[model samples]
Target: MCTSSVCNHTPKPFALHKSSSVEEYLEKNKQWSQSITNETPNLFSDYNSKGQQPHTLFIGCGDSRYNESIFNVKPGEIFGLQTVGNNLNLNDETIISTLEFTVLVLGIEKIAIVGHTDCGAVNACFDDSVYETLPKNLKNYLKPVYENIKKIKDVHKDDIPPIDKKQLSLENVKEQAKKLLSVDFIKEKFENNTLQILPMIYNVENGLVETIDL
Candidate 1:
């Protein structure tokens, strides 16, 4: 059956569907803008006129599950920076510069270091096989999470599973919050009672945050 009669085959269409579709996002944004503007006529105009004067620099996980709405944050409220495992480093220029701009320039008074439950990046710390499999840049980016987990384990190796993850996450927030104080500007501001750091963990299973008692 060697047929050359055009094969009579319908080729699959080439299109960007699912999360990869920028067109989908643009359309949704257009609809949302219309709906929101209809509800709060002056919202966008106020945002444009006032610019952003966010109160908190919310350092959070890069997990798509969490966002402003999840935290009950209105637009232009929290200056958020999302990182893998919510890892913070002074060396990461993006983190440092955001801190400098928010704290020094914008006079943001609060800092929220937040970690979440069942984080893929945090889980990878225990998977011995994951280290070599990740792309070089991704592996390097995850170094801080790993190092922090290691430090936690070294002190509390007997802890297991949910307990381990919970402590690790809470401690992660605590440690990241502490690291900000190491920054000269942050230390000065904190010492002067101008900046407050709140360490928290969002339980994905419960959708509730547990604040670290520090």
Candidate 2:
């Protein structure tokens, strides 16, 4: 009988090796490319000739579990920008430039900030020991998110119960959504009903995506 709190199903033995070497991954990629080419010969050529006009800008966590397969988006359907914890720093040029290009140039009407449960980045914010071991650049990059989480914890300590990774993940998604709306262009577009920003949480356990009401 399975006794795990989260999962009730018994674990299965691995059919193939759990970890793959670089060459193994490359070989698998070759197989995938060939399979796709054989199944849809004109896919890439059609995308190339038509040019990309993705309707949504999806900002999500760098976690491999929060992938296109979960969102059900096909190739060239979404302009994706992934980062640690799905965080968006206003001063990040890459994020800013990507947003500008997607909205202003590509004319994407929707922006979704997606966070996932049990995020390492969100968990690290609660642990002082993790900060000490992280590289300086990464620590610096994630500082804002850590601070924001801390503020939320401090301010709502009375009303809110004990903070967990799931709650933090949802809050982070909402915070990132607010941050995006803070941009003048985004604010204007949102106010005029030309754009929509959604805060979403992806549950790795159940493979579910739920909207977080802000």
Candidate 3:
């Protein structure tokens, strides 16, 4: 089990000067620790203290608006992995390691691949030309997203219709879910109904999440 100090839920904002960004974060963290402990002093205190056993695994975008706090869950209630586009690349060691630990070790049964409206990564993917100006690392990092969009268009061949970013974002959510289910252990568990995976989309304008039926 993890302590409230180990994971924060509600946050208090602090002033940040150009040179004091780090200092402000640390100060706010201190304040948060003091406040939450006062409110729920015994929160998560009676657990067995055996490492985290979060109920769900969330694959969310790295955007600040889409965070663990959005679900209104306790600090360790949701184990999360946030990426620029909430993508899943089987070749990535970090992704693979997290999957192995969560599914095989911690035994987390539920997973959600969440996307959101007004996503910069999905927008960049929709407009491939933007990639030309990006730095090498960022451009390479988003390559797969572009490739997926390309494949979607290529299927049309003759005249590719304009694709809506929101629709595309939804497609990306579905694609990531499919990618997660592609993993051997995850797929086997899913097939046997031991594991559950769902696709979700977060509406930035409304600050709500909708489940993708696919």
Candidate 4:
């Protein structure tokens, strides 16, 4: 049996339109990718041949808009662990497994914990009094931050309200770095000075990455 399927195609000329920067970014990447494949085949050839070195483990928020490449850091130089809400899940098996692999297997010399401003999770935790409801897992996931925030006895009530969100965000990042240090493999490397962990906050306002002094 012989059968033939034919297709009809229509083409349209490119027309510029006013759009969000995100849309413009997508369009630009589309053009750049096509141009790269056509003109610069070696651009990604090493990536295919070598694979990921990723000596630094980066744990950050799962925000779609916070792309690592925007930091100008090259690929295959950092091992990344992105989780929703940037909550360090010590109890989570997957999180622990990744930590172990990054430290022991990958022998990552440095781990950086990154938190950002205007985090939806931090905002929600700050205002949980209103919602009064959240899933058990989610509640559990955010327990460390909530508990840490509650323990900030030195922060006055007046100073507490506004800075609560921001302070907790920074504290959470610091605590996460500490929590990562608690891992057996991590602790050994850290104590031996073989691995170093640092925390940072990415300012949404200036797009600046500032080291968080723990």
| Every candidate's lDDT | 0.78, 0.80, 0.78, 0.72
lDDT of 1 by residue, 1-214 (tens): 5386445474534333455678777887898788778977887898836898888888899997785456776677888899887888788899999999999998999998888988886666655477446566754656656767657645655655534666767777777888888999999999999999888899898799888965
Residue-level lDDT tens digits of model 2 in 95-150: 99999999889999999888999888777765657755666775565676666666
Error of 2 at 68 (Å): 3.4
Worst 10 residues of 2 by lDDT: 8-17
Q: What TM-score number comes out for model 4?
A: 0.71
Clashes of each: 0, 0, 0, 0
What TM-scores do the predictions have?
0.80, 0.80, 0.80, 0.71
Better of 3 and 4 by TM-score: 3
Off by over 4 Å in 2: 1-23, 34-41, 127-139
**Quality of model 4 by C-alpha lDDT:** 0.72
For candidate 3, lDDT tens digit of each residue in 78-118?
A: 88999877878789999999999898988888998899999
Q: Pick out the ten consecutive residues of candidate 1 with the lowest summed lDDT.
A: 10-19
- Model 4 residue runs over 4 Å out of place are 1-43, 131-162
Best by lDDT: 2
